[model samples]
Target: MRIVSLNAWGGRLHEPLMPYLVNVEADVLCLQEMVRTQGADADWLVYRDHGIELLQRANLFEELKAALPAYDAFFLPVARGDLFEGDRRFDSEFGLATFVRRTYPIIGQAAGFVHGEFSADGYGPHPRSRNAHCIRLFDYERGYPITIAHMHGLRDLEGKGDTPARRHQANALVDLIRQVKHEGDRLVVCGDFNLLPGSETFDILSSLGLADLVTSRGYEDTRTSHYKKQPRFADYMLVTSNVEVITFDPVAEPEVSDHRALLLDLK
Candidate 1:
Protein backbone atom coordinates (compact mmCIF):
# COMPACT_ATOMS: atom_id res chain seq x y z
CA MET A 1 0.00 0.00 0.00
CA ARG A 2 1.13 3.54 -0.74
CA ILE A 3 0.84 6.48 1.66
CA VAL A 4 1.65 10.12 0.82
CA SER A 5 2.19 13.25 2.86
CA LEU A 6 2.22 16.87 1.68
CA ASN A 7 1.91 20.42 2.94
CA ALA A 8 -0.75 21.74 0.58
CA TRP A 9 0.25 25.40 1.15
CA GLY A 10 -3.39 26.42 1.42
CA GLY A 11 -3.92 25.16 -2.13
CA ARG A 12 -2.26 28.33 -3.40
CA LEU A 13 -1.02 26.37 -6.39
CA HIS A 14 -4.30 24.66 -7.05
CA GLU A 15 -3.80 24.32 -10.79
CA PRO A 16 -0.86 21.94 -10.51
CA LEU A 17 -2.03 20.32 -7.28
CA MET A 18 -5.34 19.16 -8.70
CA PRO A 19 -3.83 17.00 -11.44
CA TYR A 20 -0.98 15.75 -9.23
CA LEU A 21 -3.39 14.48 -6.60
CA VAL A 22 -5.26 12.51 -9.25
CA ASN A 23 -2.15 10.96 -10.75
CA VAL A 24 -0.48 9.97 -7.46
CA GLU A 25 -3.49 7.83 -6.50
CA ALA A 26 -2.08 7.07 -3.05
CA ASP A 27 -3.92 4.71 -0.69
CA VAL A 28 -3.72 7.36 2.00
CA LEU A 29 -3.05 11.12 1.75
CA CYS A 30 -2.14 13.32 4.72
CA LEU A 31 -2.22 17.04 4.03
CA GLN A 32 -1.40 20.11 6.11
CA GLU A 33 -2.13 23.78 5.42
CA MET A 34 -5.50 22.57 4.16
CA VAL A 35 -8.18 25.25 4.03
CA ARG A 36 -11.96 25.04 4.16
CA THR A 37 -14.73 27.58 3.95
CA GLN A 38 -17.84 26.86 5.99
CA GLY A 39 -20.26 27.17 3.09
CA ALA A 40 -18.50 27.86 -0.16
CA ASP A 41 -17.86 26.30 -3.52
CA ALA A 42 -14.46 25.08 -4.70
CA ASP A 43 -14.13 28.09 -6.94
CA TRP A 44 -11.12 30.39 -6.93
CA LEU A 45 -11.55 32.43 -3.76
CA VAL A 46 -9.22 35.30 -2.98
CA TYR A 47 -8.37 36.34 0.57
CA ARG A 48 -6.54 39.64 0.95
CA ASP A 49 -4.36 40.54 3.91
CA HIS A 50 -4.69 44.32 4.19
CA GLY A 51 -4.08 44.55 0.41
CA ILE A 52 -0.48 43.53 1.03
CA GLU A 53 -0.66 39.82 0.16
CA LEU A 54 -3.43 37.80 -1.37
CA LEU A 55 -4.17 34.18 -0.33
CA GLN A 56 -6.01 32.29 -3.04
CA ARG A 57 -7.75 29.20 -1.70
CA ALA A 58 -10.65 26.84 -2.31
CA ASN A 59 -12.62 24.31 -0.30
CA LEU A 60 -9.77 21.80 -0.55
CA PHE A 61 -11.56 19.11 1.50
CA GLU A 62 -14.50 19.13 -0.90
CA GLU A 63 -12.21 19.29 -3.92
CA LEU A 64 -10.21 16.28 -2.75
CA LYS A 65 -13.42 14.38 -2.04
CA ALA A 66 -14.56 15.03 -5.59
CA ALA A 67 -11.19 14.02 -6.97
CA LEU A 68 -10.79 10.87 -4.88
CA PRO A 69 -14.37 9.75 -4.55
CA ALA A 70 -13.42 6.36 -3.09
CA TYR A 71 -11.42 7.80 -0.18
CA ASP A 72 -12.85 8.59 3.26
CA ALA A 73 -12.21 12.24 4.19
CA PHE A 74 -11.36 13.46 7.69
CA PHE A 75 -10.44 17.03 8.70
CA LEU A 76 -9.72 18.87 11.95
CA PRO A 77 -9.42 22.64 12.13
CA VAL A 78 -6.77 24.12 14.42
CA ALA A 79 -7.41 27.72 13.55
CA ARG A 80 -10.51 29.65 12.55
CA GLY A 81 -10.91 33.31 11.74
CA ASP A 82 -12.32 35.81 9.28
CA LEU A 83 -10.65 36.46 5.96
CA PHE A 84 -11.54 39.13 3.42
CA GLU A 85 -12.38 38.70 -0.23
CA GLY A 86 -12.39 42.31 -1.36
CA ASP A 87 -15.08 44.08 0.69
CA ARG A 88 -16.74 40.85 1.76
CA ARG A 89 -15.50 38.81 4.70
CA PHE A 90 -16.02 35.13 5.49
CA ASP A 91 -15.02 32.70 8.20
CA SER A 92 -12.26 30.24 7.30
CA GLU A 93 -10.84 27.11 8.94
CA PHE A 94 -7.36 25.70 8.47
CA GLY A 95 -5.74 22.48 9.69
CA LEU A 96 -4.83 18.86 8.89
CA ALA A 97 -6.70 16.36 6.70
CA THR A 98 -6.31 12.61 6.15
CA PHE A 99 -7.86 10.65 3.31
CA VAL A 100 -7.88 6.87 3.28
CA ARG A 101 -9.17 4.56 0.58
CA ARG A 102 -12.63 3.14 1.28
CA THR A 103 -11.34 -0.41 1.00
CA TYR A 104 -9.12 0.15 4.04
CA PRO A 105 -11.10 -0.65 7.18
CA ILE A 106 -10.47 2.14 9.68
CA ILE A 107 -10.65 0.63 13.17
CA GLY A 108 -9.85 3.73 15.23
CA GLN A 109 -9.21 7.48 14.89
CA ALA A 110 -8.33 10.48 17.07
CA ALA A 111 -7.22 14.13 16.73
CA GLY A 112 -6.02 16.85 19.15
CA PHE A 113 -3.69 19.77 19.62
CA VAL A 114 -0.01 18.96 20.03
CA HIS A 115 1.31 22.48 20.39
CA GLY A 116 -0.64 25.29 22.01
CA GLU A 117 -4.40 25.32 22.46
CA PHE A 118 -6.95 26.26 19.83
CA SER A 119 -7.28 29.99 19.44
CA ALA A 120 -10.89 31.09 19.85
CA ASP A 121 -9.56 34.67 19.54
CA GLY A 122 -9.27 34.51 15.76
CA TYR A 123 -6.18 33.75 13.58
CA GLY A 124 -3.98 36.81 13.70
CA PRO A 125 -0.32 36.13 14.54
CA HIS A 126 -1.01 34.64 17.94
CA PRO A 127 0.97 31.41 18.15
CA ARG A 128 -1.52 29.18 16.37
CA SER A 129 -2.20 25.73 17.71
CA ARG A 130 -0.94 22.65 15.87
CA ASN A 131 -2.62 19.23 15.93
CA ALA A 132 -2.07 15.54 15.26
CA HIS A 133 -4.61 13.35 13.41
CA CYS A 134 -4.28 9.61 13.93
CA ILE A 135 -6.11 6.86 12.08
CA ARG A 136 -5.84 3.10 12.57
CA LEU A 137 -6.78 1.09 9.52
CA PHE A 138 -6.68 -2.54 8.49
CA ASP A 139 -4.44 -2.78 5.45
CA TYR A 140 -6.15 -5.73 3.85
CA GLU A 141 -3.30 -6.12 1.38
CA ARG A 142 -0.70 -6.48 4.15
CA GLY A 143 -2.87 -8.34 6.65
CA TYR A 144 -2.08 -6.01 9.55
CA PRO A 145 -3.68 -2.98 11.15
CA ILE A 146 -1.45 0.13 11.46
CA THR A 147 -1.96 3.40 13.24
CA ILE A 148 -0.76 6.41 11.20
CA ALA A 149 -0.57 9.85 12.73
CA HIS A 150 -0.03 13.15 10.88
CA MET A 151 0.59 16.65 12.11
CA HIS A 152 1.71 20.10 10.93
CA GLY A 153 4.29 21.12 13.51
CA LEU A 154 4.36 24.53 15.12
CA ARG A 155 6.22 27.07 13.02
CA ASP A 156 9.00 29.14 14.52
CA LEU A 157 9.18 32.13 12.20
CA GLU A 158 12.51 33.32 13.54
CA GLY A 159 14.35 30.15 12.56
CA LYS A 160 14.03 26.36 12.38
CA GLY A 161 16.32 25.51 15.24
CA ASP A 162 15.66 23.23 18.18
CA THR A 163 13.77 25.11 20.84
CA PRO A 164 12.33 24.32 24.26
CA ALA A 165 8.80 24.76 23.03
CA ARG A 166 9.48 22.35 20.20
CA ARG A 167 10.71 19.80 22.73
CA HIS A 168 7.45 20.19 24.61
CA GLN A 169 5.50 19.85 21.38
CA ALA A 170 7.33 16.65 20.53
CA ASN A 171 6.44 15.18 23.90
CA ALA A 172 2.83 16.17 23.39
CA LEU A 173 2.75 14.51 19.97
CA VAL A 174 4.27 11.30 21.38
CA ASP A 175 1.65 11.26 24.07
CA LEU A 176 -1.12 11.55 21.50
CA ILE A 177 0.31 8.61 19.54
CA ARG A 178 0.49 6.40 22.63
CA GLN A 179 -3.14 7.16 23.41
CA VAL A 180 -4.43 5.58 20.18
CA LYS A 181 -1.85 2.91 19.45
CA HIS A 182 -1.72 -0.57 20.96
CA GLU A 183 1.27 -2.52 22.29
CA GLY A 184 1.91 -4.35 19.03
CA ASP A 185 0.32 -2.16 16.36
CA ARG A 186 2.66 -1.02 13.63
CA LEU A 187 2.78 2.77 13.46
CA VAL A 188 3.53 5.53 10.97
CA VAL A 189 3.91 9.15 12.17
CA CYS A 190 4.62 11.97 9.82
CA GLY A 191 3.96 15.51 8.49
CA ASP A 192 5.61 18.88 7.79
CA PHE A 193 7.64 18.98 10.99
CA ASN A 194 9.28 22.35 10.18
CA LEU A 195 12.38 20.94 11.84
CA LEU A 196 15.93 20.92 10.62
CA PRO A 197 18.10 17.83 10.55
CA GLY A 198 19.17 16.24 13.84
CA SER A 199 16.61 18.15 15.86
CA GLU A 200 15.73 16.87 19.29
CA THR A 201 12.23 16.21 17.97
CA PHE A 202 13.60 13.28 16.00
CA ASP A 203 15.16 11.92 19.19
CA ILE A 204 11.80 12.21 20.94
CA LEU A 205 9.98 10.29 18.22
CA SER A 206 12.83 7.77 18.03
CA SER A 207 12.21 6.94 21.65
CA LEU A 208 8.93 5.45 20.49
CA GLY A 209 10.90 3.08 18.19
CA LEU A 210 9.89 4.94 15.02
CA ALA A 211 12.45 5.41 12.24
CA ASP A 212 12.66 8.69 10.33
CA LEU A 213 12.65 7.47 6.76
CA VAL A 214 13.74 10.75 5.23
CA THR A 215 16.84 11.11 7.35
CA SER A 216 17.59 7.41 7.43
CA ARG A 217 17.60 7.30 3.62
CA GLY A 218 19.98 10.30 3.36
CA TYR A 219 17.54 12.55 1.46
CA GLU A 220 19.14 16.01 1.53
CA ASP A 221 16.33 18.15 0.28
CA THR A 222 12.52 18.08 -0.07
CA ARG A 223 11.69 21.62 -1.18
CA THR A 224 10.24 22.37 -4.60
CA SER A 225 10.26 25.55 -6.71
CA HIS A 226 7.92 27.17 -4.21
CA TYR A 227 10.62 27.45 -1.57
CA LYS A 228 13.63 29.39 -2.85
CA LYS A 229 15.32 30.66 0.28
CA GLN A 230 14.66 27.61 2.40
CA PRO A 231 16.61 24.45 1.62
CA ARG A 232 16.00 21.09 3.25
CA PHE A 233 12.78 22.40 4.70
CA ALA A 234 10.76 19.29 4.03
CA ASP A 235 8.15 16.81 5.19
CA TYR A 236 8.78 13.42 6.85
CA MET A 237 7.34 9.89 7.16
CA LEU A 238 8.29 7.54 9.99
CA VAL A 239 7.34 3.95 10.52
CA THR A 240 7.87 1.19 13.06
CA SER A 241 10.45 -1.56 12.46
CA ASN A 242 7.77 -4.10 11.64
CA VAL A 243 6.72 -2.13 8.55
CA GLU A 244 8.52 -3.17 5.39
CA VAL A 245 9.45 -0.31 3.08
CA ILE A 246 8.81 -1.36 -0.47
CA THR A 247 9.66 2.09 -1.84
CA PHE A 248 10.18 5.63 -0.61
CA ASP A 249 10.43 8.72 -2.75
CA PRO A 250 10.50 12.43 -2.05
CA VAL A 251 8.83 13.29 -5.34
CA ALA A 252 10.29 16.45 -6.87
CA GLU A 253 9.14 16.30 -10.46
CA PRO A 254 5.67 17.61 -9.77
CA GLU A 255 5.74 21.17 -8.48
CA VAL A 256 2.27 20.68 -7.04
CA SER A 257 3.02 22.71 -3.93
CA ASP A 258 6.00 24.59 -2.49
CA HIS A 259 6.86 21.43 -0.59
CA ARG A 260 7.68 18.15 -2.27
CA ALA A 261 5.43 15.15 -1.61
CA LEU A 262 6.62 12.14 0.48
CA LEU A 263 5.56 8.77 -0.86
CA LEU A 264 5.92 5.47 0.98
CA ASP A 265 5.03 2.05 -0.34
CA LEU A 266 4.99 -0.44 2.49
CA LYS A 267 3.94 -3.97 3.31
Candidate 2:
Protein backbone atom coordinates (compact mmCIF):
# COMPACT_ATOMS: atom_id res chain seq x y z
CA MET A 1 0.00 0.00 0.00
CA ARG A 2 1.29 3.46 -0.91
CA ILE A 3 0.47 5.26 2.36
CA VAL A 4 1.12 9.01 2.07
CA SER A 5 1.82 11.12 5.18
CA LEU A 6 1.91 14.91 5.08
CA ASN A 7 1.52 17.80 7.46
CA ALA A 8 -0.73 20.46 5.90
CA TRP A 9 1.21 23.04 7.97
CA GLY A 10 -2.02 24.16 9.59
CA GLY A 11 -5.59 24.51 8.29
CA ARG A 12 -4.76 28.01 7.04
CA LEU A 13 -4.36 27.54 3.25
CA HIS A 14 -4.55 24.99 0.44
CA GLU A 15 -2.45 21.84 0.74
CA PRO A 16 0.21 20.58 -1.64
CA LEU A 17 -1.77 17.61 -2.89
CA MET A 18 -0.35 14.46 -4.45
CA PRO A 19 -1.60 13.36 -7.88
CA TYR A 20 -3.23 10.28 -6.43
CA LEU A 21 -5.70 12.30 -4.34
CA VAL A 22 -7.04 14.06 -7.45
CA ASN A 23 -6.92 11.36 -10.04
CA VAL A 24 -8.21 7.71 -9.84
CA GLU A 25 -6.31 5.88 -7.14
CA ALA A 26 -6.80 4.17 -3.79
CA ASP A 27 -4.34 5.21 -1.07
CA VAL A 28 -4.21 6.31 2.57
CA LEU A 29 -3.27 9.86 3.63
CA CYS A 30 -2.20 11.04 7.11
CA LEU A 31 -2.35 14.82 7.59
CA GLN A 32 -1.28 16.81 10.67
CA GLU A 33 -2.14 20.42 11.54
CA MET A 34 -5.77 19.84 10.59
CA VAL A 35 -6.88 22.25 13.30
CA ARG A 36 -10.22 24.01 13.78
CA THR A 37 -8.90 27.44 14.80
CA GLN A 38 -12.05 29.47 14.39
CA GLY A 39 -15.56 28.49 15.45
CA ALA A 40 -17.00 24.98 15.62
CA ASP A 41 -16.53 24.35 11.88
CA ALA A 42 -13.42 24.32 9.69
CA ASP A 43 -12.80 24.48 5.94
CA TRP A 44 -13.17 20.71 5.43
CA LEU A 45 -14.83 20.87 1.98
CA VAL A 46 -11.43 21.59 0.41
CA TYR A 47 -10.54 17.90 0.63
CA ARG A 48 -13.78 16.66 -0.96
CA ASP A 49 -12.33 16.56 -4.46
CA HIS A 50 -9.40 14.53 -3.18
CA GLY A 51 -11.58 11.41 -2.90
CA ILE A 52 -10.82 11.05 0.82
CA GLU A 53 -12.91 11.52 3.92
CA LEU A 54 -11.41 13.85 6.55
CA LEU A 55 -12.03 13.06 10.22
CA GLN A 56 -13.71 16.05 11.80
CA ARG A 57 -12.78 17.71 15.10
CA ALA A 58 -13.85 16.08 18.37
CA ASN A 59 -16.55 18.66 18.93
CA LEU A 60 -18.33 17.31 15.85
CA PHE A 61 -18.50 13.75 17.17
CA GLU A 62 -22.24 13.55 16.43
CA GLU A 63 -21.76 15.07 13.00
CA LEU A 64 -19.00 12.57 12.24
CA LYS A 65 -21.23 9.69 13.28
CA ALA A 66 -24.16 10.86 11.16
CA ALA A 67 -22.12 11.98 8.13
CA LEU A 68 -19.23 9.60 7.50
CA PRO A 69 -20.05 6.67 9.79
CA ALA A 70 -16.75 5.04 8.95
CA TYR A 71 -14.20 7.20 10.88
CA ASP A 72 -13.91 8.86 14.30
CA ALA A 73 -11.41 11.35 15.84
CA PHE A 74 -9.49 11.77 19.10
CA PHE A 75 -7.86 15.05 20.22
CA LEU A 76 -4.60 15.56 22.18
CA PRO A 77 -4.05 18.52 24.48
CA VAL A 78 -2.01 21.08 22.48
CA ALA A 79 -0.32 23.95 24.26
CA ARG A 80 -0.87 27.41 22.73
CA GLY A 81 1.10 30.58 23.17
CA ASP A 82 -0.40 33.92 24.10
CA LEU A 83 1.83 35.65 21.58
CA PHE A 84 0.14 33.91 18.67
CA GLU A 85 -3.47 33.00 19.19
CA GLY A 86 -3.40 30.03 16.86
CA ASP A 87 0.29 29.13 17.04
CA ARG A 88 1.05 26.05 19.24
CA ARG A 89 3.91 25.30 21.61
CA PHE A 90 6.86 23.02 20.89
CA ASP A 91 6.49 20.22 23.47
CA SER A 92 3.27 21.12 25.20
CA GLU A 93 -0.38 21.59 24.35
CA PHE A 94 -2.18 20.35 21.26
CA GLY A 95 -3.13 16.73 20.58
CA LEU A 96 -2.77 13.99 18.01
CA ALA A 97 -5.57 13.45 15.44
CA THR A 98 -6.38 10.50 13.20
CA PHE A 99 -8.43 9.90 10.03
CA VAL A 100 -8.64 6.22 9.19
CA ARG A 101 -10.08 4.68 6.04
CA ARG A 102 -12.80 2.04 6.49
CA THR A 103 -11.04 -0.84 4.74
CA TYR A 104 -9.36 -0.93 8.17
CA PRO A 105 -11.57 -0.08 11.14
CA ILE A 106 -10.02 1.54 14.24
CA ILE A 107 -10.41 -1.18 16.82
CA GLY A 108 -8.29 0.77 19.33
CA GLN A 109 -6.45 4.04 20.12
CA ALA A 110 -3.39 5.12 22.21
CA ALA A 111 -1.16 8.11 23.06
CA GLY A 112 2.64 7.68 22.91
CA PHE A 113 3.41 8.95 26.35
CA VAL A 114 5.08 7.59 29.54
CA HIS A 115 4.65 10.42 32.04
CA GLY A 116 7.21 13.26 31.75
CA GLU A 117 8.06 12.22 28.22
CA PHE A 118 9.27 15.75 27.56
CA SER A 119 9.80 16.73 31.21
CA ALA A 120 9.59 20.42 30.31
CA ASP A 121 10.21 21.74 33.83
CA GLY A 122 13.03 19.23 34.36
CA TYR A 123 14.95 20.46 31.28
CA GLY A 124 15.18 23.73 29.35
CA PRO A 125 12.26 26.16 29.21
CA HIS A 126 9.71 25.88 31.99
CA PRO A 127 6.80 25.98 29.57
CA ARG A 128 8.37 23.77 26.83
CA SER A 129 7.25 23.96 23.17
CA ARG A 130 4.22 22.36 21.60
CA ASN A 131 2.63 22.23 18.17
CA ALA A 132 0.30 19.80 16.33
CA HIS A 133 3.26 17.72 17.45
CA CYS A 134 2.88 14.03 16.71
CA ILE A 135 0.72 10.91 16.94
CA ARG A 136 0.67 7.18 16.30
CA LEU A 137 -2.19 5.49 14.36
CA PHE A 138 -3.00 2.01 15.64
CA ASP A 139 -4.86 -0.27 13.22
CA TYR A 140 -6.32 -3.17 15.12
CA GLU A 141 -7.79 -4.57 11.93
CA ARG A 142 -4.28 -5.15 10.56
CA GLY A 143 -2.52 -5.40 13.91
CA TYR A 144 -0.03 -2.73 12.80
CA PRO A 145 0.94 0.71 14.13
CA ILE A 146 1.56 3.98 12.25
CA THR A 147 3.14 6.76 14.32
CA ILE A 148 2.35 10.38 13.31
CA ALA A 149 4.46 12.22 15.87
CA HIS A 150 6.03 15.58 14.84
CA MET A 151 9.78 15.81 15.66
CA HIS A 152 10.00 19.60 15.49
CA GLY A 153 13.08 21.78 15.85
CA LEU A 154 12.76 25.42 16.91
CA ARG A 155 13.64 28.71 15.12
CA ASP A 156 16.78 29.06 17.21
CA LEU A 157 18.41 25.77 18.23
CA GLU A 158 21.77 27.57 18.09
CA GLY A 159 21.72 29.43 21.40
CA LYS A 160 19.66 26.92 23.34
CA GLY A 161 21.34 24.19 21.33
CA ASP A 162 23.01 22.12 24.02
CA THR A 163 20.01 21.66 26.24
CA PRO A 164 18.44 18.32 27.24
CA ALA A 165 14.88 19.08 26.03
CA ARG A 166 15.74 18.04 22.52
CA ARG A 167 17.27 14.83 23.75
CA HIS A 168 14.32 14.37 26.04
CA GLN A 169 11.96 14.52 23.09
CA ALA A 170 13.96 11.84 21.32
CA ASN A 171 14.23 9.74 24.44
CA ALA A 172 10.53 10.09 24.95
CA LEU A 173 9.98 8.76 21.45
CA VAL A 174 12.05 5.68 22.23
CA ASP A 175 10.04 5.12 25.37
CA LEU A 176 6.79 5.67 23.47
CA ILE A 177 7.72 2.92 21.06
CA ARG A 178 8.10 0.51 23.92
CA GLN A 179 4.81 1.56 25.44
CA VAL A 180 2.54 1.64 22.37
CA LYS A 181 3.95 -0.92 19.94
CA HIS A 182 4.98 -4.52 19.55
CA GLU A 183 7.62 -6.04 17.24
CA GLY A 184 5.15 -7.31 14.64
CA ASP A 185 3.75 -3.87 13.86
CA ARG A 186 4.79 -1.79 10.83
CA LEU A 187 5.73 1.64 12.14
CA VAL A 188 5.69 4.84 10.08
CA VAL A 189 6.54 8.08 11.96
CA CYS A 190 5.92 11.21 9.92
CA GLY A 191 5.51 14.91 10.62
CA ASP A 192 7.42 18.22 11.05
CA PHE A 193 10.35 16.63 12.90
CA ASN A 194 12.37 19.87 12.70
CA LEU A 195 15.98 18.73 12.29
CA LEU A 196 17.27 16.89 9.24
CA PRO A 197 19.00 13.51 9.09
CA GLY A 198 22.29 13.33 11.07
CA SER A 199 21.20 16.08 13.41
CA GLU A 200 20.60 15.20 17.07
CA THR A 201 16.85 15.24 16.63
CA PHE A 202 17.16 13.01 13.57
CA ASP A 203 19.42 10.72 15.56
CA ILE A 204 16.59 10.28 18.02
CA LEU A 205 14.39 8.63 15.41
CA SER A 206 17.25 7.08 13.44
CA SER A 207 18.95 5.64 16.49
CA LEU A 208 15.69 4.06 17.51
CA GLY A 209 15.52 2.32 14.07
CA LEU A 210 13.30 4.72 12.08
CA ALA A 211 14.87 5.34 8.66
CA ASP A 212 14.49 8.48 6.58
CA LEU A 213 12.53 7.60 3.45
CA VAL A 214 13.74 10.70 1.53
CA THR A 215 17.45 9.98 2.00
CA SER A 216 17.20 6.17 1.99
CA ARG A 217 15.22 6.17 -1.21
CA GLY A 218 15.44 9.03 -3.76
CA TYR A 219 12.09 10.80 -3.40
CA GLU A 220 13.28 14.38 -3.14
CA ASP A 221 9.86 16.06 -3.20
CA THR A 222 10.98 19.68 -3.34
CA ARG A 223 13.94 21.88 -2.42
CA THR A 224 14.47 21.92 1.33
CA SER A 225 13.51 24.66 3.82
CA HIS A 226 10.03 25.27 2.45
CA TYR A 227 9.84 27.83 5.28
CA LYS A 228 12.99 29.65 4.22
CA LYS A 229 14.40 31.41 1.14
CA GLN A 230 15.30 28.04 -0.41
CA PRO A 231 12.82 25.84 1.51
CA ARG A 232 15.51 23.37 2.62
CA PHE A 233 14.17 22.26 5.99
CA ALA A 234 13.91 18.44 6.42
CA ASP A 235 10.39 18.07 7.71
CA TYR A 236 10.55 14.35 7.29
CA MET A 237 8.47 11.20 6.65
CA LEU A 238 10.34 8.41 8.42
CA VAL A 239 9.66 4.66 8.69
CA THR A 240 10.64 1.83 10.98
CA SER A 241 12.86 -1.16 10.19
CA ASN A 242 9.98 -3.48 9.37
CA VAL A 243 8.47 -1.66 6.38
CA GLU A 244 10.21 -1.64 2.99
CA VAL A 245 11.09 1.94 2.14
CA ILE A 246 10.04 2.97 -1.36
CA THR A 247 9.85 6.70 -2.15
CA PHE A 248 10.34 9.65 0.16
CA ASP A 249 9.63 13.03 -1.39
CA PRO A 250 8.11 16.38 -0.51
CA VAL A 251 5.60 17.78 -2.98
CA ALA A 252 7.10 20.62 -5.02
CA GLU A 253 3.98 22.69 -4.43
CA PRO A 254 4.14 26.30 -3.36
CA GLU A 255 4.07 26.94 0.38
CA VAL A 256 0.42 26.65 1.35
CA SER A 257 1.38 27.08 4.96
CA ASP A 258 4.89 27.67 6.31
CA HIS A 259 5.92 24.12 5.42
CA ARG A 260 5.37 22.08 2.25
CA ALA A 261 3.75 18.65 2.01
CA LEU A 262 6.23 15.76 2.52
CA LEU A 263 5.49 12.20 1.39
CA LEU A 264 6.65 8.65 1.97
CA ASP A 265 5.59 5.63 -0.14
CA LEU A 266 6.18 2.32 1.61
CA LYS A 267 5.68 -1.29 0.65
lDDT of 2 by residue, 40-128 (tens): 33333221112533332322223322434444444443432111213321222233344455655443335544223333222234333
Worst 10 residues of 1 by lDDT: 41-50
Per-model TM values vs. the true structure: 0.94, 0.62
TM-score of 2: 0.62
- Which prediction has the highest TM-score against the true structure? 1
Candidate 1 Cα misplacement greater than 4 A, ranges = 47-52
